[model samples]
Target chain A: MKKRLLYFCKSFKINFDELEIYDKDFIFGVLGVLVEYLSGLLMMFFIYDFVEDINGWSLDQVLFFYGLNLVGYSLWSCFFINTITLPYYIQRGEFDRFLVRPESPLFQIMMDSFDDDSWGELVTGLIILCYSWIRLRIPPIYFLALPIIVVSGCLIYLGISIILSTFSFFTIAQADVANITMEVKEFAKYPLTIYPKVLQIIFTVVFPIGIVAFIPGMVLFRQIPWQLLLVIPLVAIVFFVLSTRVWYLGLKHYGGTGT
Target chain B: MGNEIITVNRLSKQYHVRIITEGNIIKRIFSKKKYKEIDALNDVSFSIQEGQYVGVIGNNGAGKSTLIKLLTGILYPTAGQVSVMGRDPFNDRIKNNRNIGVVFGQKTQLKWDLSPLESYDLLKTIYGIDDETYKENIKKFVGLFEMEDFINNPVRSLSLGQRMKCEIAAAFLHNPSIVFLDEPTIGLDVFSKDSILRFLRSIKEESNVTLILTTHDLEEMNSICDRLIIIDKGRIIEEDTIEHFTERFTCSKSIVFCIEGDIWKDINPIDNEVLIVDNGKVIVSNVRKERVNEIISLMLANNTINDVQIIEPNFTEMVKKRINEGD
Candidate 1:
C-alpha cells in the first residue's frame, strides 16, 4: 500500500512538472474557464428572459443544472482526456510502453498528462453550486450527499469517454469521432424537457448523460423524487465497471493483433 | 550457462489484417468483412541465461519486432509458452515488467516535456527503486553516458544523442535484471553510437545484466554482443557465437567508396553487387576479398574520391545474399 501511494503521488508530481503550467499560465487558464462558464450562464439568462421557466424550471434551477455539468465534466476531463489520444498512441505502438511499465495501462495513460483547464472549472463549479444552493434555500441534506453525487456523476462521464475512445483500438480512427460523442453533454446542460422528445429518451436511457449531474439537479428542483438520486450511483458503478472491462478487452484485441 | 532467465517454447503470434482491395469507396466502406491471417511469428524458440548478451538480427518484417513485443509483454503469443523470470510475460505482465528494461530505437519513451532527471524520478517511483540506489544509478549513468550538460533540459530540446542517452538512463535507473534494446543506435552520430556501444560493453562486466539487442548493424554485434540469433521469415535461421557466425558467413569483403557528386551518373551498370546510396553517393561493392583492391582501383580511376574503405558486408545485405545462395 505504501509503495502504491508513493507511485501515485510521484505520478502526479511528474505530470505537473511535465505540463509546466506556471502560476501565470494557470491564471490564464482560469480566465479561459471563467469566460466559458459566463458565456454558458449568459445563454441561460437569455432563455429565461423570454420565458418564465423551462418546463417549470426557473433561472436558478437552470444555473444549478449548468454548474453540475461543469463540475462533472471538469472531473472527468481532468483524468480521462488522454483517452481521446488513444488512436495516435495505438497507431504508433506507443501504447506498448504502458503495458511494459509496472502500472496498469489505463492508469499510466491517464496519469501521463495533466489537463490544466480542469482546475479553474472546479472553482467555478463550486461558486455556482453555492450561489444556487443559497438562492434556492435548499435543505442541508444535499451538502452531505454532494460528494457522493459528484463521484457518481464524474464516473458516468469518465465511463462514457472511455467506452467511446476504446473504439480507436479496433478502428483506424482518431480523436474527432470520440470527441463528437462528448456533445451529449450539451443536451445534459439544459433541462431534459427543453430538448426534443427523442433526445430526452436517448440521453436518459441510451447515452445516459442525463444521470451525470442533471438528474440530481432535477431532485433539488422537485421535478423528480430524491429516491431517483439513489439510482444515479448504482448506474454509475455498473457503467464505470463495464466500461473499464471493455478497455481491458480492447487491450486483449490489441495484444493479439499487433499494430 | 547460468540459470535460464528467459525461455520461449514454440511461441507464435498471428495477426488478422484487413484486406482493402476494392477501390470503390462506397463498397469498400460498406463491405468491411475481408481479413487475411498472417503469422508474424511462427514456432520460434530460444533461451537466454543470466548475464548473457544476445543480439536478435533480421531483415524487415521477419518477426523481429513481434518477438520483442511478445517477450516484453506488449503482445500476446497465439500458441506455445514464453517464460521471462519464471512467469508468462503477457499474463504476468506487471510482475515481469519489474525485472526488465526496454529501449526502442527512434521511439520516445521519455515524456517530451520532462527533463531526464524528472523522468528518472518518475521511474524510481514506478519501479519502487530505493532512494540510495536510484541516486547511485543516476550518477553512474550520467557519468557513463556523459549526460550532465543536458540532463536538466526538456527531452524535446535536447540533441538526439542527448535525448537517447537520457532514455537509456531512464531504462537502467531501476537496475532491471535484463535490458532489451531494439536498434538503440539507429540514426545516431558516430560519436554517440561509439559511446552507447562502449557503455553497453562496460556495463556487462560491472552490472551482470542480461542484454537482448535487436538491430540492423551487425558491426555492433562485434562491439557489445556475445551471441547472435538470426531470424528470417519468422524462424530462427541460426544461433551461434560472434566468432563462429563471422567465420562462416562473412565470406565477401565490401569496398565502400564515397565519391564526388553523381559519380555513377554515366557509368554503365557494372554488377548487381554494387549498391548506390543517395547522399554523398556511397557506393558499396560486395566482391571477393581478393578483389577489394580491384573494386577500389575501378572506383578511383573514374571519380574524385572523398573516402574509401574496405569493410564487411552489412547484416541485411549479407543475409540477402546468403538466402539467395541457398545457404
Candidate 2:
C-alpha cells in the first residue's frame, strides 16, 4: 500500500509538470471548475429559497448535505477521475501495459491521471461545511468524526466508480452508462425523506448514494441516533469489497483483443 | 548452452470473440451471448537458453504477438504451460516480471507529457531499483543511444525514433535478464533503424541479457539474431540456428558472366545446369558452389568473359521458400 501511494504521488507529479507547460490552459481549467462549482451552489440556493423546509429538513441541514456530497464528489474526482478513461484504455489496447507491470493494475489505472480542477470544488465544499456547522451549533465531538465520515463517503464514490468502469472490460461503449449512473448520484444532494419510498430504498441498498451524504446529514441535524453513524464505515467496507471483486472478475475476462 | 531462461510445453491461447449483429436492442441484451473461438496460438513449444538472441518472424495473424504476450504474462494461456525463470508466468506474474522486460513497438509506455528522465524515475520507483544501479543503467543507456539531446524533452515532442529509444532505455533500467522486443524498428527511417540495430548489437555483445525479437524485417533478423523461429497459422513451422536455416533453403546459386561479344552459340550448357544467353551476357542457374570454378573455366575457355558475379539467396527468399514448402 505504501508503494502504491508513492507511485500515485509520482504519477501526480508527472501530470503536474505536464500541466505547467500550458499554464494558460491550466488556469482556464481551474476557472471553469470554479464557475461550475458556483453554479451548483446557486442551484441548491434557488431550491432552498422557494421552500421553508424540504420534508421537515431546514435549509441549513440540506446545505450541510449538499456540502457533504460535494466533498465526496470532489475528493473522488481528485483521486479516481481517471476511471472514466477505462473505456478508452481498453479500446486503444493500452491496458496491456498495465498488465505487464509488477503492481496492482487497478491501482495503476486509478493513478493514471489526476484532476486538478477538483481543488475548486474541494475548497467551496469546505467553506460551506464550516458555515453550516457554525449555523447548526453542532457539538465538538462530532468534529472528530468528520474526517472519518468524509473518507467513508469518498470510499462509496470510489467503489461505485470502480464498478462502473469495470463494465468497460466487457464492452468499450460503457462510458455512457457510467456517466449516467454517476449523474444519478447528484440526486443525493437533497434529503432522502422527500423522495419516494422506492428511490429511498434503492439509494440505501442498491446505489448507496443516500448513505454517502443523507445519513451523515441526519447525524449532523441530530435527527437520527448516533449509533447509526457506524453504518457509514460498515457500508463503505462492504461496498469496497464487493466492487473489488467485480473489478477482478472484469479483469479475468479481459481478452486484450483488437491490438 | 547456459541454463534455460524460458520454456513452453504445448502452450495455446484461444479467444472467445463475440460476433455482434445489428439486432434489436432488446434481443441484444436478453439473448444468450454468442461467441466464436479463435485460436491465436495452437500447441506450440520451445525453450530458450540464457544469453541467446532469438528472432521470431511470422505474417499477420500468425500468433507472434500472442506468443510474446503469453511469455510475458500479459495474457493467460488457455492450455499447456509457460515457465520463465522457473516460474509460471501467469500464476507468478509479479515475480516473473522482475527479471523480464517487454516492448510493444507500436505502443508507447512513457508518459507523453513527461521527459524520458521523469519516466525513468517513475520506473525506478516502481521496480524498486537501488539508486546506484538506476544511475548506472540510465547513464549507460543514455550514452549508448546518444539520447542526451532529447532525454529531457517531453515524450510527445520527440520523434518516433527518439521515443522508441527512450522506450527501449526505460525497459532496460531494471537490468532485466530477458527482454522481448516486438517490431522494435517498425516505421523507423534508415538512420534510426541503423542506430537501433547497432544499439541492439552492442547490447548483445556487452551483456548477458537474452533477447527475443519479433519483426517483419528479415534483414534485421539476419543481422542480429543467432537463431530464428518461424510461425505460420498459429503453429511453429520452423526453428533452427540462423546459419543452418539459411543453408537448408539455399539449394542453388545464380552466376552471371559478362562477355565482350556474343557467345551464345559457342557456350554449351552442362547437364543438370541451366544456361541462357541474353544481350552479350551468359546467365547460369542451379550452379553448385563447388562447380563455380569449373563453370567459370568452361565459360572462359569458350568465350571471353569480362565480368563475373555470384548471387546467394537472402533471408527473405529463404523464408519465402520455406513457407511455400510447408504449404
Candidate 3:
C-alpha cells in the first residue's frame, strides 16, 4: 500500500514550478474550485441569516452539515470527476489507453485530472466549520472528530462516482445517467430530519447518502445513535468492491476502436 | 530457432453498436431501432518466434487494428486465445505488463503539459526503474534522437515528429523486451521517417527485441520487416517471408527502352501486347524473369536501343494489386 501510494503521488504531482498560471487547464481548475467554494459559502450564509435553526437544531449544526457535504463533494470532484465523464471517453475511444496500463483502469481514470475548483470549496468548507464551532462554543472533541467525518465522507463519495461511471459500459448513452446521479447527490446536502420519514429511511438504509453526510453531522453533535460509525468504512468498501467488479466485467466488452 | 514468444490462435472480435440517423422528430422518437453487429476480426491466427520482426499490413478496417488490440489485451477475443510471453495480456499484474511496450500512432502516452524529461522521470517512478538505469536510458535516447533541443520543452509545444520521437523514447525507457509500433512512422517527414526506421532497425539488431509493426507504408515493411502478414476483409490473405511473398506476386519485369527507329510500326513485339508505343519509342510488354534475356536480345537485334529502364514490382503496388484482387 505504501508503494502504491508513492506511485500515485509520482504520477499525479507534476512539476508545477515550470507551468504558467495562465495555462488553460490550470486556469479552469482554479475557476472550477472557486465557483464551488463560493456557492457553498453563499448557501451557508443564506441558511444562517434566515432561520435561526432548522429541524430542531441551531444554525451552527446546519452549517456543520453543509461544510461536511462540501468537504466530501469537493474531494470527489478533486479526484473522481473522470468517472462522471466516462461516456464521453468511451465514445471518443480514449478509454482504451487506460485499459492498457498496468494499474486499474478505474484508478487511472479517477485520477486523470484534478479539479482545482474543489480546493476553494474544501478551504471554505473548513473555514466555515471552524467558525461555526467557535461561535457555538462546541467541545474540542467535535473538532477532533472533524477529520474522521471528512475522510469517510470522501471515500463514500468516491465509491459512488465509481459506481455511476461503471454504468457507461452498459448504457451507451450515459450523460443522462450522470445527471440523475448528481440530482440524487444534491438531495443529501441538507439534514435528513427535514425530509419525510420514508425518504429518511430510504436515504439512510437503501442508498445511504444520509450515512455519508447527515449521520456524520449527527455524530459530531454527540447524538451518536447505535454503532453506525463503524458501518461507514464498511459501506464504502462494499460499494467500491462492487463497482470494481462491474468495471472489470465491462472492460471485457471494451473493443477499442482504432483512431 | 526458439519458442514462440507470442501466439494467437483463431482470434475473433465482434461488437454490437448503435448509430442513430438524422430524421424527423417523430421518426427519431419511435424508431429507436438502429443497432448493428460488426465482426471486426474473423478467425485470424498466427505466431511470432522470440526476437522476430513482423509487419502487419492491410487497408482501413481490414482488421489490422483489431488484431493488434486483441494481442495487446485491450480487447477480448470473441473466440480463441492470445498469449504473449506465456502470460495472458489482460492479466491484471504489473509484472506481466512490464515486458511489453506499445505505441499507437493516434494516441500519445506522454503527458501533454509536462516536459519530456519530467514525463520520463514520472514514468521511471511509476515503473519503479532505478535512478542509474533511468538516467542511462534517457541519456542514450536523448543522444540518439537528437532530443537535447526539446527535452525540456513541454510536449504540447514540440512539432509532431519531435513529439512522436518522445513517445517512442518513453516506451523504451522501461527496456521492455517486446515493442508494438502501430503506424509509428506515419505522418513523419522523409528525414524523420528515415531516422525512425534506422533507429528501429538498430534497436532490433542490437538488442534482439521482438517488434510487431502495423502500417499502410509498404516502404517501411520492405526496409524493416523480414516477415509479412497481409489481412483483407477480416481474414489473413497471405503470410510468408517478405522475400517469398514478393517473388511470388511479382512474376513479370517491365522494361521501357527508347529506340532510334519507329519500333512501334516496324517491330511487332509479341503482337499488340506492347503497353506503350509512340512515334519511334516503345514500352515493351511485361516479360517473365525467365524470358528477360530472350526479350532483351530480341529488342537489341530489332532496333537501336538509346536508353532502357527496368521496373520490377514495388511493394506498394504489389499490396494494392493484391488487396484489389482479394476484394
Candidate 4:
C-alpha cells in the first residue's frame, strides 16, 4: 500500500507539471468550475422558492441534497474532466503514448489536472452543505457520513465515465453515447424519492448515484431504518473495482493503430 | 556486438470482428450475425545483432508496424515467442522496456500540451535518472537535434520536422541499448532527414545502440543500415548483408554518351541492353560498371564522342525492381 501511494504521488506530480504547462488552459478550467457552481446554486434557489419543499421534505433538506450532489459532481469533475476528452485523444492516436507508459492509463487520465473550475463548485458545495446542516440541526454522526457520501459519489461518476469512454474502442460515432450517459446521470441531480419507485430502485441497484446523494440524505433525514452511511464505502469499492474491470476488458479489444 | 539482441520464433497475431447490422427495429434488436478473424501477422521469425543497423522494407499492409507493435509489447502475439533483451516483450514488458527505446513515425510519446523541455524533464523523473545525468543527456540531445530554438514551445505548435526530432530525442532520453525507429525520416525535408540520420549513425558508432529501422526508402537502408530484411505479406522474402543484396538483386547499370555522328539507333555493344536512342544520342543498360571504359571505347570507335556519362542503379530503383521481380 505504501509503495502504491508513493507511485500515485509521483504520477500526480507528473500530472501537475502537465497541468502547469498551459496557463490559458488552467484559467479556462477554473472558469468552467466556477460557472458550474454558480449556475447550480442559482437553479437550486429557483427550485426552492417555487417548490417550498420536495416530497414532504423541507427546503433545507433539498438544499442539503443539492449540496451533496454538488460535492459529488465537483469531486468527480476535479479528478476526471480531462478524462472526458479521452475519446478525442484516442481518435488522434495520442492515447497510445499514455498506454505505453508503465503506470495505468486510467490513473494518468484521472490525475491529469487539478481542475481549478471544480474549485468553485467545491467551495460552494461545502458552504451549502454546512448551512443546510445547521438549518436541519443534524447530529454529529451524520457529519461523519459526509466523506463517505462524497467518495461513493466520485466512484459512481467515474464508473459511468469509464463505461462511456470505453465505447470508443468499438464505435466510430461515440459522441452521442457520451452525451446520453451524462444526460441520464443528470436525472440523479434530484432526490430519488421524487423519481418513480422503479427508477429509484434502478438508480439504487444499477447506477448507485443514490449511494452518493440519496442514501446519505436518508441518513441525515432519519428516513431509513438504520444508519445507511456504512454502505457508502462498500458501494464505492465494489463499483470502482467493477469499473476498472470493464475498462481493461475494453482495452483488450482496442487495436493500437490506425484503420 | 553479438548477433542476437532480438529473437522471434513463429510470431503471429489475429483479430476477431463481430458483424452488426441495422435492419427493422425489431430485427436489429434480435438478429445475430457471423464473425470473422483477420490474420495480421503470420508465423514470422528473425533475429538482429546488438549493433547492426537493420532496415525492414515492405509495401503498406505488409504487417511491418504490427511486427514492431508485437515486439514492443504494445500488442500481444497470438502464437510464438518474441524476446527482446532476454525478456518476453509482452509478458514482462516493463523490465524489457528499460533496455529498449522505440519511436513510431506516425505517433508521438511526448506530452501533447507540454513544452519539449517539460516533457523531457517529466521523463527524467519517470525513468529515475539522476538530475545531473539527465541534464547532461538533455544538453547533448538538444544540441544534436537543434531543438534549442523551440525547446520551450508546446509540442502542438512545432513543425513536423521539429516534432520528429523531439520524438527521436524523447526515445533516446533513457539511453536504452536498443532503438527502434519505424519510418523515422518519413515526411521530413532533406536537411532534417540528414541531421536525424547523421545523429543515428553517430550514436551507432559512439555507443553500442542496436537500431531496427523500418522505411520504404531503401536509400535509408543503403546509407545507414549494414543488414537488410525485406518483407511482403507478413513474410521476410530476403535477408542478408547490404552488399550481398545489392550484388544479387540489382539488375542494371546505365551508360550515356553523345555521338559525333547522328547515329541514334542500332548501335550495339557486346552483351549490353540498348535502353535509350535519340538524335545524336545513345544509351545502353545492363552493362557492368567495370566495363564502362570499354563501352566508351566502342562508342568512340563508331562515332566521335561529344560527352560521356555513367549511372549505376540507385537504391530505390533496385528495391522497386526487387518488388516487381517478387510479384
Candidate 5:
C-alpha cells in the first residue's frame, strides 16, 4: 500500500511537470476551476436566501450539509475520477495493458490520472465547513467525529463510483448510467426530509448518497440517536467490499475482444 | 538447451458472443438474448526453451493474439493448463507479471500526458527496480534507440515511430527473462522497421531473454526468428526450426530464361518436359536439383538465351502456401 501511494506521488509529479510546460493552459485550467467553484457557491447562497428554512433545518445547517458533500465529493474525485473512463478503456481493449502490470488494476486506475481541478473544490469545501461549524456551534464531540465522518463519506462515494464503473464491463453505454447516478448526489446538498418519501428511501438505502452529508448532518443536529452514527462506517465498509467483489467479477468476464 | 521457460498443455479459450437479429419494431423490442460460443484457442500445446527467439504466425483470427494473452494472463483459458516460468500464469498473474514484459503494437501503454522518462520512473517504482539497474537500463536504451531528443517530450507530441521506440525501450527497462511482442513493427516506416529489428537482433545476441514474437510479417520472422510456430483455426499446425519449416514447404524451384529467338519449337523435349515460352522468355519449374545443369544445357543448345535466373521459394510464399493447404 505504501509503495502504491509512492507510485501515485511519482505519477502525479510527472503529470504536474508536464502541465508546467503548458503554463498558459495550466493557468486557464486553475482559473476555470475557481470560477466554477465560486459560481456553485453563489447558486447555493441564492437558494438558501429564497428559503430561510428547509424541512425544519435553517440555512446554516443546510450550508454545513452542502459543505460536507463537497468535501466528500472532492476527495473522491481526487483519486477515483479516472475510473469513469473504464468503459472507454474496455471498449478500446486498452485495459489489457493494466492486466499485464504487476500492480493491482484498481490501484493503477486510481493513480493513472490526477484531477488538479478538485483541489479548488476541496479548499472551498473546507472553508465552508469551518465557517458553518462556528455558526452552528455544534457539540465538541462532533468535532472529534468530523474526521471519521469525512473518511467514511469518501469511501461511500468511491464505492458508488466503482460499482458504476464496473457496469462498463457488461455494456458499452454505461456512461449515462454513471452520470445519472452521480447527479443524484446533488439532492444530498439539502435535507432529506424535504424530498419525496420514495426519493428519500432510494437515497438512504439503494444508492446511499445521503451517507455523505444528510446522515452526518442528522447526527450533528441530534435529530437521530448517536448509536445510529455507527451505521456510517459500517455502510462504508459494506459498500466498499461489495463494490470490490463486483469489480473482480467484471474483470473475470472481460474477454478483451476488441483491439 | 536451457530449461523450458514456457509450457502449455492443451490450452483453450472460448467466448460467448451475443447475436442480435434484425426484425420489426415489436420483435426487436422483445428480442431474446441469444449467445453463440466461439473457440479462440483449441487444445494448443507448445513449449519454449529459455533464451530462444520464436515467431508465431497465422492468418487473421488464427488465435495468435489469444495465445499471447493467455500466456500473459490477460485472458483466462476455458480449459487446459499453461505455465510460464514454472507458475500458472492466470492464477499467479501478479507474481508472473514481475518477470515478464508485454507489448501490443496497436496500443500505447505510456501515459499520454507525461514524458517517457517520467513514466519510466513510475514503472521503476512499480517493478521495484534498484536505482543502479534502472539508471543503467534507461541510459542504455535511450542511447541505443536514439531517443535523447524526444525522451523528455510528452507522449502525445511524439511521432508514432518515436513513441514506438519509447514503448519498446520501456518494455525492456526491467530486463525480464521473457518478452512477448505482438506485431511490434506494425504501422512503422521502412527506416523505423529496420532500426527496431536491428535493435531486437542486438538484444538477442547480448541477453538471454526469451522472445515470443507474433506477426504477419514473414520477412521479419525469416530474418530474426530461430523457430517458427504456425497456427490455423486455433490449433498449432506446424512447429519446427526455421530451416525445417521452410524445407517442408519448398518442393521446387523456377528457372526463367530471356530468349532472343523462338527456339522452344526447335528443342525436342526429353521425357515430355514442357518449356513455357511467353514474351521472348522460356520458363521451367519443378526442376530437380541435379537436373538443373542438364536443363540449362539443353536450353542453351536450342535457343539464344540473354539472361537466366533461378528463383527459390521465399518465406512469405511458403506461409501463403501453407495457409492455402490448410484451407
Candidate 6:
C-alpha cells in the first residue's frame, strides 16, 4: 500500500506541476470554485430570508450542511473529477494508457489530474464551518472530527462517481450521463428533512447521497449520538469497495467482449 | 535462439455486437437489441525470441491491433493462452506491465503542459527507477535523439517528429525487455518517419530489447525487421524471415513482351494467366520461376519480339494486394 501511495504521489506531482506553466488558467479555475461556492451560499441565504427554517433546523445549521457539501465535493473534484472524461476516452478507445501502466487504472485515472479549483473550495468550506461552529457555540473539540467526517464524505462522492463512470463501457455514455447522479447532489446541499418523504427515502436508501453529510451532520448538530459518526465512515468505505468491483466488471466488458 | 520473450498459443478473441437495421429514428430508438458474435482474432500462434525485431503486417481490420492488445494486456484472449516471460499477460497484468512498454500511433503520452524532461522525472518515480540508471538513460536518449534543444520545452510546442522521439525515449526509459509499437509512425512526415525508424534501428542494435512493431510501412519493415508476420482476416497467413518472404513473394514475376507489331490475339490459352495488351505490350503476370524460360522461348519462336522484360513484384504492393485478395 505504501508503494501504491508513492506511485499516486508521483503521478499527481507531474499533473500538479503543470499549474505553474498555466498559472493564469489555474487562478481563473480557483476563482470559478469561489464563484460556485458564493452562489450556493447566496441561494441558501435567499431561501432562509423567507422563513426561519424549513423543518426545525435554523439558518446556521443549514449553512453547516452546505459547508460540508462543499468540502466533500471539493476533495472529490481534486482527485476524481477526471472521471467525467472517461466516457469520451472509452468511446475513442483512449483508455489503453491506464491499463498498460504498471499500477491500477483507477489509481492512475484519479491521480492523472489535479483540479486547482478544489483548493479554493476547501478554504472557503473550512471558513464557513468555523463561522457556523462559533455562532452555534458547538464544542471546539468537534473540530478535531471535522477532517475525518469530510474525508468520509469525499469517499462516498468518489464511489458514486466511479459507479456512474463505469456505465460508459456498456452504454457509450457522454459526460452528462456519467455525471447524471450529480444532479441529486444539488438537493443534498440542504437539510434532508426539507424534502418529501419519498425523496428522503431515495436519498437515504437508494442512492445514499445523504449519507455523505446529513447522517454525519446529525451527530454534529447534537441530534444524534456521537457513536453514529463511526458508522457513517464505514458506510462510505464499504460503498467505495463495492463501486470499485462494478468498475472492474465494466472494464472486463470493454476489453474482453467489445471495444 | 535465446529465450522466448513472448509466446501466444492459438489465441482467439470474439465480441458480440448489436446490429440495428432501423432506418427511422424513432424505430431505432425503440428497436430491440440484436447481437451478432464476431471472431476478431482466431487461432493465432507465434513466438518471439529475446532481442529479436519482428514486424506484424496486415491490412486494416486484419486483427493486427487485437493481437498487440492481447500481448500488451489491454485485452484478454477468449481462448488459448498467452505468456509474456512466463506470465499470463491478462491475469498477471500489473506484473507483466512492469516489464514491458507500448506506443500507440498518433497519441502523445507526454503531459501537454509539462516539458519532456519533467515528464521523464514523473515516469522515474512511477517506475521506481534508481537515480543512477535513470540519469544514464536520460543522458543517452537526449544525446542520441538530439532532444537537448526541445527537452525543456512543453510537449505541445514540439513538432510531431520531436514529440515522437521523446515518446519513444520515454517508453524505453525503464529499459523494458519487450516494447510493442502500434503504428508509431502514422501521420508523420516522410522525414519524421525516416528519423523515427532510424532511431528505432539504432536502439535495437545497442540493446537486447525485443521490439514488436505493427505498421503499414513496408520499407521500414524491410530495413529494420528480421522477421515478418502477415495477418489477414483474423488469422496469420504467413510468417517467415524477411529474406525468405521476399524471395518467395517475388518468385512469380510479371513477364512483359514488347512486340514489334500488334499481336494481341496470337497467343493460345495457357494454364497460367492469359496474355493481355497494355499500351501495345503483351504481358503475362504471375509467371512461375522455372516456366519463365520455357514460356519466353515458346513465345519468341511464335512471334517477333523486340524486347523481353521480367519485373519482380513490389514488396509493399504485393503484400497489400495479396491480403486484399484473401479478403
List runs of model 5 lying over 4 Å from the truth. A21-52, A139-142, A223-231, A255-259, B24-26, B254-284, B287-310
TM-score of each: 0.84, 0.92, 0.88, 0.83, 0.88, 0.87
- Locate the minimum summed-lDDT window of 10 residues in model 2 chain A: A172-181
lDDT of 6 at A162: 87
Candidate 4: residue pairs that collide: A30-A117, A33-A117
User: What does chain B score (TM) in every candidate?
Assistant: 0.79, 0.93, 0.88, 0.89, 0.89, 0.81
User: Which one wins by lDDT: 2 or 3?
Assistant: 2
lDDT of candidate 1 over B1-327, digit per residue (tens): 589999999998888888877678877887756889898888988899899999998889988888999999888989988999999889898998999999988788898877888888878878889989988988899899888898888888998888788778777878899899988888889899889888888888798799999988877776678888878888887778876766566656666667777645333334546666767766555465555666667777877888887777565565555555532
Q: What is candidate 6's lDDT per residue for B1-327, written digit by digit as tens?
A: 579989999999987777877679888778876888888899999999999999999888989999999999888988989999999987798889889988887676788888999888877877778899899999988977888999999999998888888989999999999999999888789987887888888888888989999998898888899898999889988888888887777767878988877654435545665567777688888777777888788889877888999988877976766676673
What tens-digit string does per-residue lDDT give for candidate 1 at A114-198? 6777788877887887888889888987887788778787887777778877888788645455675468667777778778888
- The reply for model 3, stretches above 4 Å from the true place, is A15-19, A23-50, A142-144, A173-176, A179-185, A220-222, A225-227, A255-259, B19-23, B32-34, B91-96, B256-285, B293-309
Q: What tens digits encode model 4's per-residue C-alpha lDDT throughout A1-259?
A: 4534554575567666666666678778777766776787688778878886778877788778878877877787766756566677677766666555555667666655556556677777788888888988888776666787787887787777777777776654446454444564467767788888898887788777765777777765757854567787788778878877887777666743223
In terms of docking quality, model 2 is acceptable
> Could you give the CAPRI-style class of model 5?
medium
Candidate 1 chain A weakest ten by summed lDDT: A173-182
Look at candidate 1 and tell me the lDDT of residue B230.
Answer: 79
**Top candidate, metric TM-score:** 2
Q: What share of the true interface contacts does each candidate keep?
A: 0.83, 0.55, 0.38, 0.16, 0.66, 0.67
Worst ten-residue run, lDDT, model 4 chain B? B263-272
RMSD of 6: 4.9
Please give the distance, in angstroms, between residue B86's alpha carbon in candidate 3 and its true position after superposition. 2.1
5 or 6, greater by TM-score: 5
What is each candidate's DockQ, to 2 decimals?
0.50, 0.48, 0.39, 0.22, 0.50, 0.51
Flag clash pairs in model 3: A32-A117, A33-A117, A33-A118
Worst 10 residues of 3 chain B by lDDT: B264-273
lDDT of 3: 0.75
Worst 10-residue stretch by lDDT in candidate 5 chain A? Answer: A172-181
In model 5, the Cα lDDT at residue A78 comes to: 66
